[model samples]
Target: MKPQIACVLIFLSVGIALGECDELMKELGRSKTSLGGLANELVELRQIQRRVGRRIRSWEDKARQNEVYLGRLIEQRSISEGWLARFEEINRKLLAGEISSDDKEERIARNIVRIAEFQAKIDRRQATIDFRIGKIEKAQAQADLYRSRFEARESVVADIEEQRDAKKLLVLTLEADLEACKAGMA
Candidate 1:
């Protein structure tokens, strides 16, 4: 009678322990699945961030190019304006009869043509520079928006990592406690 009772007690104890182990195993599996999903999301987010960074770099390069072109246009405009001023001064002298040199008259006529050409070039370059500046400004704005999104994702990634670490610690603690409980029961 004593042997039978002890055998039944052992059987019941094993069944209860097996149930608990199954439950813990299920929970661990769930945690692992969640961690895997989170990892996949992190990978996708990182790829998107890389793309945004590339776009921002492209915009910056274009902006730099436009700035250099704008500088050149400004210099050209300054030169053209200076030439026009000199040509007007020469014309005034010629009209006032203060200069009677034929060479000066011919030089002033040539300068007028040159000034017209320079003015046209300056106008064309200014238009191009203006268009490029507008494009660069738009690109910069888009880049700023992407950068903000990247930062937000970065925060999310940090949060996920922290959660995963905490979850792993929890699993470890649960496993240790479960082992101790089993040993005590035995």
Candidate 2:
């Protein structure tokens, strides 16, 4: 009777061991699934980061080009001012009677029209410069926004990596436990 009781107890223990092993396997499967999902998310985040980096580089290049254009606009404006100054001096000399001739008067009128045309060009150029500056500022702002998003995604990826590592460790431990249970049963 004692031997029979011992055999029953052994069978009961084996059953419990098998059940525990089955549960561990299920848990390991779930962990592996979770780790796979995390890995996919990390890959997506890396892709986004690369795209954001490219956008930042493109914006920087546009800003540099705008700066060069602005410089050229400034030089043109300076030249226009110089021409206006010379025209003003000519008008002042005419008014002071230091030069008197119909040709001189005609020349003065032509200079006035030329100066007016130059002023209009300067105004238009200034407007264009302002528009370019606004666009550059907008591009810079977009670049900054993209950089922030990239950084945020990087942090999320790091967290996901940590979780994946922990899951991997848990799965390994569960596998070891399942192996031990099988050995015991054998």
Cα lDDT computed for each candidate against the true fold: 0.84, 0.89
Q: After superposition, which runs of candidate 1 have C-alpha atoms over 4 Å from their true positions?
A: 1-57, 97-100, 103-108, 158-186
**For candidate 1, lDDT tens digit of each residue in 44-76?**
999999998887578767767877877877787
List the lowest-lDDT window of 10 residues for candidate 2: 55-64
Weakest ten-residue segment in model 1 by summed lDDT:
55-64
* Alpha-carbon TM-score of each model against the true structure: 0.48, 0.50
- Writing each residue's lDDT as its tens digit, candidate 2 over 13-33 gives 999999999999999999999
Which candidate ranks first by TM-score, i.e. highest? 2
Error (Å) of candidate 2 at residue 153 is 3.8
